[model samples]
Target: MIRVYRIPFSTNVERVALAAAHKGVEIEWVDVDPADRSPVREVSGQDLVPVLVADEEVVFDSPRVLAWLDERHPDPPLWPRDVARRAEARVFVEWFNRVWKGRPNEMEAELRKDEPDEARLQALGRQMVAWLDLFEELLDGRDYLLGDFGVADVVAFPFLKYGRLGLPEGDDELFHRILVHWQPIGEGHERLAAWVERVDALPRA
Candidate 1:
């Protein structure tokens, strides 16, 4: 059986888990404490949730794990089959990852705080929307990020979950407070909004 070492509420872990589900791959999830990641470290040589253990081998990194799963289960491929489109998808994934480098830290601080900084949230939201704007423009009349429901969508979907419309369907005050900075792009970003609904409705792992 495939094993995934992950803690709850991790974007990195969510990326891998969602991809596995989308590809119809079953995973034995091992939840570890975020403060103490010894279990994953023993296998991955580093403390990272989303470590994939399969075929007597251990893999780290969400992108690497996702690609490996795609190869291991090709029926519902996570990447495009057309060589050029596949390359294009890889480029976009890399770009998104690169631009999103420091966003998690900022987002975590903002969302987890008892009293989120309105100014900070506003600035963070603006920056995020700018990035989303690029995607909005790119997604003009398309169903998914790369014209299909694939890895690119899976990788970026977790971050968008904190938005008002996408915040986990729960009753946590922090989740509600985080919504302060999150404004729905509904008609302004029509295509992306539709895509959000589609991705949110996908079966999760």
Candidate 2:
């Protein structure tokens, strides 16, 4: 059995779990806290969660983990088969990891601030909205990022889900609009939603 070192609330870990589930791969979950870096470093010689350990192979980083899983279990493909579509999926995954790092901090400020500083909150909201608009433009008239559910969708969904839950409290309309854009590609889509449910049902490690 494959062993997955993970943090339950991490979007990165969720990406790997979702992909594994999508590929019908069962993984032994190993929970590790961010503060407890020793166990992770001991396993993979690095301090990152979502490390996948198989016989003689250790994969760190969520994207690499997803790719590793896809390569090992090719059935129910996580990536688009078309070359161009695959490239697009990779592009979105990169953007999510690199460009969206500030989202969580911004969201935290927006949600937890006692006085709700309008300037900071609006700036964060605008930044997120810009990304949302970009996603809308990319997803215009399409059901998923690459016109089919794939790795990009799985990688991107967790951030959106986290943002909805953590940020912009009392903004139902905003969240609803975001969900409307996300739902068809996320919860409303059978394959993707099933993957989500499977991940959700997993025992916390």
Candidate 3:
């Protein structure tokens, strides 16, 4: 059986769980708190959730986990088969991980309650809006980033959740718009939304 070390609320862990479900791959979910980092370090030599231990092979990193799962079970493909489209999907996933994950300011207000600086919060809001604007441009008329709900969508969903929860406390209007935009995109697709719901409903381990 595949064992996955994860945290329920983590988007990164959620993506792996969702992909495993889509592939009809059963996983032994191991719940871990981000704060209690020692368990992970003891097992994998690094503190990270969404660690996949299968058949004595340890796979860390969400993207690598997805790729390993795909290779092991190729049906209901998470990545595009066409070369160009596959490259596009990979690019989006990379950008989503790198660029989208850098919006620490979105969570700054909550993280720093003792010294709430208005200027810093406002700057974070503006920066978040700029990033959302970029998403708007990228998602102009597409259902998914690469015209299909693939790995990119799974990777992007968690960050979107963070934006919805974090940014609203700082800038309500911007958060509302982003949430609205994302709702339809996520809801419009049957498989994608169903996958999300399945993961959301799963019994945490």
Which candidate, 1 or 3, has the higher lDDT? 1
Error of 2 at 39 (Å): 1.3
Clashes of each: 0, 1, 0
Worst 10 residues of 3 by lDDT: 179-188
lDDT of 1 by residue, 1-205 (tens): 9999987777788898789889888899998987898888888899877899987888888899988888889978889999999999999889778765355457667767899787886777677666667778878878888888898899877766555364454434443334334535666777777777788888877
**Which lDDT value does model 3 have at 5?**
88
Per-residue alpha-carbon lDDT of candidate 2 for residues 1-205, written as tens digits (9 for 90 to 100): 8999886466678787777777778989987866788889998998988889999999998889889988989988988888887787778778787776465455565556677676776665567655655655555566665676678777876666543343334434443343333334333234444443433454322
The TM-score measured for candidate 1 stands at 0.81
Query: What TM-score fits each model?
Result: 0.81, 0.70, 0.71
The superposed Cα distance between candidate 2 and the true structure at residue 70, in angstroms, equals 1.0
Model 1 poorest 10 in a row by lDDT: 171-180
TM-score result, candidate 2:
0.70
97-188: candidate 3 lDDT, tens digit per residue? 77655545254433358766767655655565556555545555665555666687677766554433344343344433433343343323
Instruction: For model 1, state the Cα shift of residue 78 in Å.
Output: 1.3
Q: Which stretches of candidate 3 lie over 4 Å from their true place?
A: 105-121, 137-142, 162-205
Which residue pairs in candidate 2 collide?
Answer: 31-205
